[model samples]
Target chain A: MEDQDYSPKSRRRFLRKFGSLGLGTLAVSTGLTESCTNPTKDLESGKKITLLNSKNELVEVDSAYISNLNKDLAPNHNSESRKGLPGKKFVLVVDLAKCKNARKCMDKCQAVHQLRPDQHHLNVLLMKDSEHTAPYYMPKHCQHCDNPPCVKVCPVDATFKRSDGIVLIDNERCIGCRFCIAACPYSARSFNWVEPKDAEKYKDVAYDIEKNVPQKKGTVTKCTFSADCLRDGKLPYCVSACPNGVYYFGNEYEDAVTNGTSGETVSLSELLAQNSAYRLMEDLGTAPSVYYLPPKDRTLIPEIEDTHS
Target chain B: MARLNTIVAILIFACSLGAFSQTTAWEVSADQATKKNPLEILPKNLALGRNIFKRTCVSCHGEKADGKGLIQSTNLIDEKFQKQTDGVVFYKIITGRDKMPPFGAMLKEDEIWSVINYLRVLVDPSAIPPPKNVKLELTTGEEIKSITAIVLSADSAKLPLNEVDVHFYVKREFGLMRIGEMSNYTGADGKVKVVFPEKIVGDSEGNVTLVVKIENNFLYNDIETTAVKKWGTPLLSHEDEFNRRALWGARDKSPVWLLLLANGIIAIVWAVIVYVIYNLFRIKKAGRIFIK
Candidate 1:
C-alpha cells in the first residue's frame, strides 16, 4: 500500500469504494446494525453500535444515534418525548400579585431553548382592559389544555396531550401546517418560518420534543413545562429562574407547588383558593393546567414601556 | 502518480500544521497562561459549575460533556480539547465562534473559570482527589430553632477543622432549598454552632430535614450531613384540600345540572333507539301476514 502510486482521481475512486464497502463491512461486523434490532437490550448491555441516524449520518453509540433508533427503545418520557410520567399530573400556578413584568422567566426560557430572536416560549403580556382595573403583567405559555383545541385541530397527531398535562409537538411528524397555531386562543404557539440561526449548532443533536431544544424550522414549538428537568426531580427553568416567585410548579398528585423564589412549598388547592386562582379564557372550557391569581396586591407599578401587550 | 502521492502527503502535513497553529492562537500571554486558578477546584465549585452547565450549555455541550448535546457542538472529551491550557480554554469559552454563543455576557469571570475547572476534572478524573476520611456530626439542643454541627477526622481524636463554611439547607420537594449560609470556623472544642431561623420550618408534622454541607475545602472531600428534627412552624396546612376541590375538571368539579342534563339526553336517545327497533319488528310481521 505504501508503494502504490496515487492520483487525485484514483484517490476519489478509492475513497468511494472504501466508504461504501469497507465502512459497510465495519458497520456490520461491529454489530452497529443492532441498533435497528434489539435496541433496548443493546442499550442495557452498554454495547457500542454504529448506525445511520435521523440526519443520514453514521453515528456511533451516541445520543444523536440513540434518539433516532426508535421510541419503542425506551418507554420513558425522557427519550420517547410523547409519554408522560406515569400517574403524575403536573400543574402551574402563577401568582399575579408577585409578577412585576421583570421578564426574568421569559429571558431564561429563551436562553435555555435557544429560541429565535422573535419567538419566545414564555410571553409576559400586560393587561389593563379598562380604566377602572389596574394593570398587571401576565406570563403565559401553553396551558396544556385537557380539552386542547390545538390537539383537536391538528391534522396529524403531531401535537399531543401527555398524561402529565403537557402539550408537546413532535417536529418530525409535523407537516408545517399552522392549524395548531391558529387553533390556540392564548397565542402560545410560535412558528419557525425560516431555519433558526442556531440550527447548525443542533445539527448533530437528536431531537427530544420534551426539551424542545435544537428547534427545527417550519415546526411549532411551545413550552414543555420543562418535562426534562421534572424527570430529574428539578424545577423548570422559568420557575426556578424567576426572581419574584411569580411561578409555582408541582405535581397535582402531590398537591403542592413550590414557589421558585421563596422555596416555599404551598398546597396547590389552598394557594388557589387563598389567591383566587383562575385560568385564562375559562369560559371556552379548554381546562388549562396553568392557573393565575389576580394581580390584586401590587408589588410594583410595572413600567408600561416594557410591557408587550 | 508519484508526484500526486507527494502532494497528498504534503496536504495532510499542512492541514495538521494549520490545526496545531490554530490552538496556539488561542493562547493568552505567557503570564496569563501560567496563572493559577484563583478559585479552589473543589467539589463545591464543580457542583456550581455543573449547575451552570446544565442551564447554559447542556443543550449544546450535552449532559456528559461528550459534545453529543442536543445542540451538537464540541466534544468536550476530545483529547485536543483536554490538551489546551486553562487560560486558552477560558478564552475560547468567553469569546465563542460561529454556532457557539458567547457566554462572557451571561456568565461572570469566576463562573467561567469554575466551568473550566469542571471540564478539567471531566477530562481527567484524577484531577479531583479522593474523599478524605472526615466524619460530620450534627445535633440539635433543647430548642428546635438551634443546632450544633461538628466535623472531625474519623481516625483521629475529633480535631476541629477551622474556617470551614458549613451550609444549612431545608430539603424541599424538588431539591434542597438553601435558606441561608454561615461561615463558621470550628472552635477549640471541635464544634461549630448554627442557629436555625424561626422561618426555616417543615411540614405539618413540625419536622424539617436540615442538611449541613462543608464544601470547597482543599484538604477534605465534600461532606454533606443531614438531621431531621421537630423545628420551625408547620409550613403545610392541608394535604387533603385536593380531595374535593372544584378544579381541573375532576369528578367532584362536574356540575350537577350539567350531569343531570347529560344523563337525561342519553336516556332519551337510547329510548328512541329501542322504540325504533320494536316498530321495525312489528312491521316485518305485518308484511309476512299480508304475503300469506
Candidate 2:
C-alpha cells in the first residue's frame, strides 16, 4: 500500500510549524529552507516573486530574490520587535596580570556561538620571534571597534554600528564577498564555511538572529560583542569561560566589571591601572574593546614553552 | 656543438615532415577552425587555442592534460608548456583527422592541419626544444607560532616528569616565587602539558614572554622564556584574529559612565557655585560700606 494517506496541504503546513518559534534548529546539512519552493520578492527587478522547481539548483526565479535579504536572519535592524536590544553600553578590562592563555574562554565562546572549533570569535595565538626569543600565546577576538573597518567596507551596509556603539553584522544581507575580512586590521571577522557543522549537534541552543544563525557556509562572521546575551541579561560566553580570569564583562553604566566565569567584581579603571592596561593596535586607531595589562615582573621563566604552544 | 647540431637536424626533419602524424598518437585534437600552422602559431596565440579547446572538449577530455593539472589547481609541475610543441605538432592540432573536437565552425580548410601541427609539439615531451633560462619568485611572512607536538627528532631529550609542583619565580634581587602545578607527569614524548588558566598578552607586534618552572624536577630547573625562542610566543592564525582585537565597549570604565549618571548632580553643584559667587559680590559691597 502507498503511504499517501495525508494530503499535500497538511504536509506543507507540518513543515512550516517546524522551528517556527525561532529557537530550536531544524536546518539540515542540505540547507532545507522551510518554504522550499516559495519566493516573496525579487532581488534585481524588485517585484513579487515565485519559486518553482528548477533543474537541480535553487536559483532565484527572478532577479528580485536579492531584495529583503535581512528578512530572514538578524532582524535586529529590519524587525521592529528587536529594534533596541541594548540602549546603554557595555565595557570590560582584562587583567593581564593573571593570564596564561588557558584557552577555556575560547572554547566556551565556540560552544555558545555555535562556532566550529577552528572558526572561533576568540583566539589565543602564540607570539614568536627569532629561534631564541621568548614565546607566549596571545588571545584576541572581535574588537567591536569604535571605528570598525569591517563596517566601513561592507557594500550592502550588512554590518552597522548600534546606537550604543557596538558594531554588529547583519549576516542575512552579507554578500559573502570577504571584503570585510581584508579591511579589518585586527582580523576579527570569521567566515561561515560549510553550513556551520557545529550548530546542528547542539540542537538546544536558542537561536538569536543577531548571533548570525546556523552560521551558514560562505559568509563573513565575527563576535557580536555578546549583545544577545546582554539582551537576555546573561553574561557573554567568553567572560565566564576563563578559569584563570582572562576576560571581564560588565555594563559601562555600573563603573565596574566581574570576571565572566567568577562573579568577582573590580573597578574597571583601577584594574587597568594596577595591571597596566594597553590596547592591541593603538597605532592603527581602531580603538579595540579588548584591553590587556602587561605581564611583567615574572618569576620562573615558562619552561613548558615548546609544549603548550 | 653536438647538441646544437642534433637540434638543427630534428627541427629540419620536423619542419619538413608536417603536422598530421603526431597529434593522433598523442591524442592532440583540433578544437577550432581558424587555427593554422607557424604562419598562425605563436606564443601570443595560445589563448585562441585555449578558448577553442575549453568550449568544445573540456568535460571528458580533462584540462590541458599535463596530467596533475585541473583549471584551478594552479599546478606548477605541468607549467612547462614549452617543452612539448614544435612546428609539426602544430599542424595536427589544426586538422582533426583523429578523435578530437574539430573546429570546422570558422576555419579555412588548410588552416586546420597547420594548427594541429603546432598543438602536438606542445603536448609531446620529446618535441619542443629546451628553454634558455629559468628563475623563480617566492614571498613569505615571519613565523611567530610555537607549535606543540611530539618531537620524534633524534636531537631531542625525552624527560620522564610526572606529578610535579611548579615554582614560578619572578626575576628580582629577592625575587618573589609563586607556586602552581599540573599535578601530573609529563605525557608521552617528554611532554608536560601546561594548561594556561589565563590568556597570554602579546605586544602590538604579537610578542610576549613566559617564565615556567616545575617544582618536582629541580635539576631540570626553571625554563625562562628568554631561552627558548619558540617558548612564550604563540603563532596567530594568518587570518581573522588581527581584526577582532581592536575593540573596547561603547564606553570606557563605568566610573566614567557613573560620571554621566551624575549629570543632574553636577548641574546642581554648578547652580550652587553661581549662587555663592553672587553672594560674594554682595558681601564685598557690604564690607566696603561697613569699612567706610
Candidate 3:
C-alpha cells in the first residue's frame, strides 16, 4: 500500500485508450499535424510553436501555431473557397500596340503568383491572319466573359459568374472534369497535368484569398485579370509590363480608361472610336472583359521566325 | 493744243508704263540674279504661292500660322522638331518624307516651291510688306508657325505632373465653315511639341485653325496644358496614310514575346495553384465524397 507503484500496464492502457484522441487533438491544435509527428512531447523544435517556418527559417507570424500553418498555399484560378470581392466590375483592355512579347511581365507575374514553369495565366498567342504578313503576340488570359460557356456546362455550378463579372471556380467542388477547358473559346483555360515542382518550391507562401493561394493539384486555371492588383489600385503585371501604352484599364462605370502605365485617362468609347478597336473573336460573343484594338497600323510583337533578322 | 495733248498723254502713259516696267523687271531675271525685293514686283508669283499654300498646307497647320491644322493632320509646329530648311521642306514635299507620302508624283516642282513660299507668308504675315499705295487690312492670324514640342516628365521639370494628359485639337473655319477634331494621350517625357508647317494655309484670313490641345492623364482633373498654336485657312487633309501608319507602327511595334512572357506570369501562377490542388485530394478511395 505504501509503495503502490505504476506499471507499464497502466501506461500502455493510457496510450491505447487516449493515444489516438489526445495526441491527435494536441497535434492539430498546436499546428504540428502536418509535420506528421504526434503532438505530445515531441523533441524537435520544428514541431515547436515558435517563429520558425517549415524550412526552419525565422518568420514573423502573429501566433506561434501560425508558424507551422500552411496559410499561403493556394490552388489555381479555381480555389475551393474563393469568391470575388463585391461592388466592383473588373475590366481589362489589351492594346495590341503596346505589347512587345517581353517576358518580364510573365516573370513578375509567375514570381508573385508562384506559377508552374512552362505554364502561365497568360499566353502570348502568335496571331496571324495568314503567314504572309506579320505575326503579332496576342496575350490571351481568361476573358472572364459576361457569358461564360464554361459556367453553362459545369453540370455542377462549380464554375460560375460573379456579380462583378468574374468567372470563378470552386476547386473544392470541381470534379477535374475539364469541361470548362474544352468549352472556352479563347483557349484561355489550362489543365494541371502533373504536380508542379515550382509550386512546391513556393510551398511556404502565405495564401491570400484574392490570389487563390496555396494552389493544390488537379484543378483548372486561367487568367484572373490580376484582380488583386486592381483592388490595390495598381496596374496588373501585363499592363505594366508593356512599355508601349497598349493595355487600357478602366472602370466601365466611369467610362474611362488608361494605358497600362502613365494612367492617361480617356473615354473608353472614344478610344475605341479613335483606334478602330475590336474585340477578339467577336463573332463568338463570349463578351470578354479584355478588348482588342485591331492590329491596324503596326505589329506589336512579331513571330520568332520573323524577328530573327 | 496738239503739243499740250501730247504732253498730257505722254505723262499718263509714262506713269503707267513705269509701274509696268517695275513689275516686268521681276521676270527678266527669273532664273538669273536681279532681285532688289521680289515681293513688291512679283505679284503673280506671290499670288501663286499664296494660292498653293492655301490648297495644300491649310489642312494640317492651322489658320493661325501655328503648327496646328484645321484637320489636325501631321503637325508642322511640333516642338521636338527641328525646323526644316526651305530646301528640306521642298525635298519633303517632293520625296514625301515620313507621312507626306511622296507628293512628288502628285505635285510639280514649281508647285512645291510655291507652296513653300506661301508657307513663309504664314510664318510671318507681317513680313509680307503691303503694296506701297493700296490699303490692305492686315488681320494677322495666330503667329505660331512650325513648332517642335517635347513633354518633360513632371519630375524632370520639377513639376507635380505625375499623371498628366495631352490632347491635340484641330479646328477649321472657311467663309462660314467650321470643323474640329481632338486627340489625347500621356507620356513619361511629360511634353509633346507640335509643329505647324509654314506650308499650311490656315495662317491666311478666313481659314481653319489648328492648335495644340492637351489634357492631363487623370480623367477627373481639368486638362493642364501648354499654350496652343493657331493656323489659318486652307484646310488640308492627309493625302496618304503613311504618317498614321508609321506613328502607330512605332508605338505598337514591340516584340511579342515580351508581352507573352510578362502577362504569362498570371497563367503560371494559376498553374501552380492547380498543381497544388491536384495533389491535395485523396485518390485511394477509388472515387470521391463531399462532406460539406
Highest DockQ: which candidate? Answer: 1
Tens-digit lDDT string for candidate 2 (A105-203)? 787777767777778787877656456855555677777666777776677777776544467776667789988899889888888767786655634
RMSD of each: 18.0, 26.2, 26.3
Best candidate according to lDDT: 1
Find the candidate with the highest TM-score and give its number: 1
Model 1 regions lying over 4 Å from their true place: A1-79, A303-309, B1-172, B176-292
DockQ of each: 0.05, 0.01, 0.01
lDDT at residue A169 of model 2 (Cα atoms): 73
Residue B168 in candidate 3 has what lDDT? 44
TM-score (C-alpha, index-matched) for candidate 2: 0.38
True contacts kept of each: 0.05, 0.00, 0.00
| Model 1, native contacts kept | 0.05
Ranking by DockQ: 1, 3, 2
Better of 1 and 3 by lDDT: 1
- Pitting candidate 1 against candidate 3, the one with the higher TM-score is 1
Candidate 3 DockQ vs. native:
0.01
